[model samples]
Target: MDAIDEHIVSLLRSNGRASFSAIGREVGLSTNAAAVRVRRLESSGVITGYQAILGTDAPDGVAGLEAFIDVRLEPGRDSEEFLVWASGTRDVLDAVHVTGPYDYLLRVRVRGTAALDGFLRLLKREAGAAQTQTRLALRPSAAGASARERF
Candidate 1:
């Protein structure tokens, strides 16, 4: 993408709801021009989709506790099984197959400690995770804010 396209992406990343006019104002393009560029970005798959970054108090907010669970699969167990389960499971925000001490890293969100405990229990029982190390996330920050501030 060109510089202007990159700028448009940056603005959208910070605020997906930004109007085309606002983007034009910031990037020195007319509203129509901005709209055309944005449409191109979308059609080209550069702009996949927009999403709201809900706060803790949102109705379906991620305001609860977040944890990164490093999972170790049982010997001879297939990692694909766990990956597929995680992909379809609610509350699992992300699951990444990593090369390290753990077989996979699961990013999970829950309402409280009790909920997290229950989720972990269910994970162990059903996911075929032989062992896991859970680390609680502290004061998660927004990626958009950081990028905006830097630029």
Candidate 2:
């Protein structure tokens, strides 16, 4: 990808709903040209998908909690099974297989501590996790912030 393509990606990352015209204006391309470039990025798997960033409070006025769960699988456990289960889980926002002390890192969202506790119990019982460490996120950085700034 060229510099223009990179810039388009940055714009899209910050605002996935940005119009082609807006992207074109920012990147010095015509609207059609910007749309074509975005299509190319999508076809090449550079842009896999778009997602909405939810606030701490939902539209229904319920506050949500976020947590990161570090899980270590038992020896001889089927890692694929755990991965598949985590992927299909409703409260699991994201799961990554990592090269570290933990076998997987799970980002979870729930309504309350009771819900989190229930989810953790289910994960341990069903996923065969030998151990787990859960850390509640006190606050998340602004969604519009760049990755470097958030980190």
Candidate 3:
């Protein structure tokens, strides 16, 4: 994928339901061109499935818990292999390689404590995570808010 494809992916990540026409306008492409690119991305497995997010006030399922987990891989484990697993895992919203005690930091959302426990077990069993430290997110920063505005 090129720069235009990267931009298209970013637009879709922010709003998966955005129309091809809207994406085309943002990326300086024709509607059909945008559609073609999106189709290519889907076929290439870069664009996964999309889903609806129920609001907190909604009468159905409760808003999920968000947390960050610092992961240390097992001895002689492959970082690339772990990354592949992280990318495919549904609850792992973001994974970053960072300079720290841990090899990676993952941002995730799950139903509740039981679901969180299950995910942790899966991470250790399937992803080769040797150690992990977790922190619950009390709240997220406001969208489009700058550092100065955040405080």
lDDT string for model 3 (54-137, tens) is 333323445777889999999999999999999999889899998878999999888877889999999999999999999987
| Regions of model 1 farther than 4 Å from truth | 1-60, 145-151
Please provide TM-scores, in order, for all candidate models, with all chains considered together: 0.56, 0.56, 0.58
Model 2 C-alpha RMSD to native: 15.1
- Among the numbered candidates, top TM-score falls to 3
Q: Quote the lDDT for 76 in model 2.
A: 97
Residue-pair clashes, model 2:
0
Error of 1 at 70 (Å): 0.4
TM-score of 1: 0.56
Model 2, CA-based lDDT: 0.89
Report lDDT (CA) for all predictions: 0.88, 0.89, 0.90
Which residue pairs clash within candidate 3?
Answer: none
**Measured by TM-score, how close is model 3 to the native structure?**
0.58
